[model samples]
Target: MTATATIDEVVCLRPATSTDFDLAGVINSLLKPVYELPGAELVHHLSGIGDVGRMIQDALDEAPDDLYATGVPSSGTDHAVWPVGGTTVEAGAGARLAVGITLPVDGSQDIFLWDQDASSDDLLGSVTISEAEQGQGSLSKLAHSDEEHSYYYVNYHVD
Candidate 1:
């Protein structure tokens, strides 16, 4: 008797981890989402020299093709100081930066990654400034223009 061809079933195998893997991510924000670190800051700055018109033109000329990232990210303190340190950019005519920071759900502590250089920036209004402007006068305009003004009454918690 001719042996009938036996129909067979086969199974493809996969690595244990691949099949039974554990992965986590915020798929859908249930209630205002959760961030390991929450808070967004909108920082605006004017870097360069010349009159308001010139400064604006210069800023625009030197503006990054992408306005969103014109300057590199430095410590809030350092970013503040850069304007005054150089002979190229006028001390007062340096960068005028502005950014908005959204406070974290877990208090200010869970906001920014408060690194070594970045202490809790005592905010002036909702805006956090560079270190140079700290301890100045009423606002950035007063601080950068006046020599007597120093220190800010605000801080950005980045821890």
Candidate 2:
């Protein structure tokens, strides 16, 4: 008998025997975007992304009224750029890279990844970091690409 399953509406694989089946192989082939929840609710900005990350946190630490007055904390709006954290790295082609990001609030946040080397700062894509994520953790493949050295700028905020 053969075992088969439908994965992500694409790719079908059959296993001749249960013992011979490789689950890891199937997971690796599925290149679908994953949306994950945060491990903990974050009330403060995560540290260690350099100065911009700190400055954004400073602006957000102010009172809501003050934030509104200064227009620095751009929370609760679409298309708003909130500084979460960022890093630049060099990796081999098709290598999986892990990035740790900390976000504020116990709500949904969008994580944006950009290629700084590009003229337009080309946006690759975004993944939603759910409330289940902790203030600090590692996300795989934020640096995943075919390029020998990838330059990434990551930013995100609660929405």
Candidate 3:
């Protein structure tokens, strides 16, 4: 008799949880080029003197590089706050940080996430976001790391 794989068996073999995905090679693939980019020193230097750049460089230097991640609701609430590490990235003051948040969907919501410098808002990069039905109450977070800067804002509705 020949052995055959069932759908259930295949599904079981696939990664289904965040931890499973985090362990997979996907994060490495996504982050390697970012750290290996040419003129890393120049970028870091231009970023100025702060622990934010150092922290990012250190994280990149590690064997398995990992980006920080956090999640929030898809809807509700007129105003929301997103702290780098749930507070200022450092214990001391005068630390400068300029991290960006890459939203799962584009044009889904205007200015979905923004830093203190509202006039210079920018998106981080492209990321795969799973499809969810409307009003499903699904939660999605703008995932990324940060530095010595302050809070971020999440505006759900325009009006």
Strongest candidate by TM-score: 2
Each model's lDDT:
0.20, 0.26, 0.26
lDDT of 2 by residue, 1-159 (tens): 221111110000110111223432343244212212121111112222244323422332311110000012222223223222333333221112333233343354444433333233333333454554433333221322222111222223222
Question: Residue by residue across 77-143, what tens digits does model 1's lDDT show?
Answer: 3433222332112112122333333222221111111112123322111132343432333332111
Full ranking by lDDT: 3, 2, 1
Candidate 1 Cα errors over 4 Å, as ranges? 1-53, 56-60, 69-98, 103-159
Give residue 3's lDDT in candidate 3 (0 to 100).
Answer: 19
> After aligning candidate 2 to the native by TM-score, how far in Å is the CA of 143 from where it should be?
10
Give the local distance difference test score of model 1. Answer: 0.20
All candidates: CA RMSD in angstroms?
A: 27.5, 19.5, 17.8
Each model's total of backbone clashes = 43, 8, 0
